[model samples]
Target: MKTAVILLPGLNRDRDMIAAITHISGEPPVTVWQTDTTIPDVDLIIVPGGFSYGDYLRCGAIAARMPFMKALKEKAAQGVKVIGVCNGFQILLEAGLLPGALMRNASLKFVCREVELEVSNASTAFTSGYSQGQIIRCPVAHHDGNYFVDDATLKTLQDDNRIAFRYANGTNPNGSIDNIAGILNAEGNVLGMMPHPENLIEHAHGGVDGRALFESALGLVAA
Candidate 1:
């Protein structure tokens, strides 16, 4: 499957994301710059983590307004799969491509560590490689990973099984609402998550627990 990675100033994780995708799919992804007004045809588009625009305006607030994001929104509307990790997740929410918002960590500090995540909804293209309720290890590094949503929207997400990954095993690093580590859009083609799955997809990262996500997104296995 062809993939693309979004690049912006201050984003430091694009290389890791590109490496993961290339290693898993045996193909390097096209890199899209923030100033670019269009994105090429691709099966998956990833917004990797880092402090975009130096996180000057509430994490991804500034990056969300970039020209590239407009193209991303259009691709999302067309059902192209999109995954945004860490700051990228914040950008997606800021761009209105996904629901809810991510706020500062409950402890009001930066957090970096491994956390367990449960596969809350394994039916989506992003989670089909795992079984519902299955737990996996992933790394997270962010200062504003706390996720929140209103009661009504939370209920809707629950009803629709859109919650993809939840912090499991008492490892709620940022105190996100309902332990939400990841979620899917209404169409299930877009995913926004705080954890850095790209950092954990290889054995050199100590484990390959995060490989299934890319595998699923690329349709490498039968769902």
Candidate 2:
């Protein structure tokens, strides 16, 4: 399957994400610069992790206004699959492609380490490779990873099965409500998560838990 990986200024993990896609799916994702006006022809799009715009106003606030994002929003509306990681997740929230906002960590510090994530909604294309309640290890590196949404919106997400991943084993690294680590949109085609699945794509990185995320996307395209 063809995938397009978008990179914004200050983006640091584009290569890591591209390697994960190439290794797991045997396809090298096309790297699109943030200034590009057109979204490439691909089955999937990934906004990789990084300190976009040096995290100036906010983590992803500036990057969200890039020309590429406008096209991304249009593709997303057409049901194309999109995955946003770390700062990418923040961009999604800034662009209104996903609900909720990522705030400064409750501890007010940058957190970088492996985290356990529980699969809450395996029915979505992003997490379908894992069974419900399955725990997977992925690395999270961010300062503003605290996810926040109003009670009413949180209730709506829960009702719609949009809460896809949560901190597992009762550990809330960033103090997100209900330990939410990731979520999907109502349509289940878009996913945004704080954890860096691309970092765990190889055993050399400590585990292969992230391989399934890319593999799952391949399965979705194949089906």
Candidate 3:
């Protein structure tokens, strides 16, 4: 699939994301700057993990208002797939592309390590490579990664099969409401997650579970 990575100031994991997508899809992803108001036509857009804008006001608060954020919303309306990892997920919430918020870790510490996720709804475009109830390990590096949503919203997500991934038993790195590690927007075209799937695409990273996501996107675009 044709992919582009959003490059924001203080974005830390841009190179890692670029490398992983290049390796998984066998195509290099272009990096688009935050200041840009327009994005190229592509099958997918990725907002990778990083401390955008130095995490001054919450995690992704500053970067969320950039012009590209608006462009992304437009692309989503056009049915272009969008994936946000870690801080990118926070931005999606701030931009109102997704519901809920990412709160600070319950421990209030920067959690950086590999975590296991139980695939909740594998039927979506992003998880077609995974199986329902499959557990995949991916690294997460962030300070504010706890996912939160009200009871009604949470129930709506559950009833709609929108929860993408949940932390494996006892693997909830942060105190996310319902241990939600990832979720899909109402249309299922947009995905926001805290874990860094791109980090797990390389064999050297100890697993290839993340490849399923990239492969799924490619397959979806091909379809």
- Top TM-score prediction, candidate number: 1
Off by over 4 Å in 1: none
Q: On residues 1-223, what C-alpha lDDT tens digit does candidate 3 reach at each position?
A: 6999999988888899899888877889988999899999899999988889898888899999999998999999999999999989999888899999999999999999988999999899999888889999888888999898999999999999999999997889999999899999999999999999888887798888788888887683344
Clashing pairs in 2: none
In order of appearance, the predictions have TM-scores of 0.99, 0.97, 0.97
Top model number, lDDT: 1
Give each model's whole-structure lDDT.
0.94, 0.90, 0.90
What tens digits encode model 1's per-residue C-alpha lDDT throughout 1-223?
Answer: 8999999999999999999999999999999999999999999999999999999968899999999988999999999999999999999999998899999999999999999999999999999999989999999999999999999999998999999999999999998999999999999999999999898887789999899999999999674
- Please say which candidate is ahead in TM-score: 1 or 3: 1
For model 2 the local lDDT of residue 14 reads: 89
Model 3: residues with Cα > 4 Å off, grouped in runs: 220-223
Residue pairs with backbone overlap in model 1 = none
Worst 10 residues of 3 by lDDT: 214-223
The predicted structure with the larger lDDT, 1 or 3, is: 1
Deviation (Å) of 167 in candidate 3: 0.3
Q: What is the lDDT of residue 202 in candidate 3?
A: 70
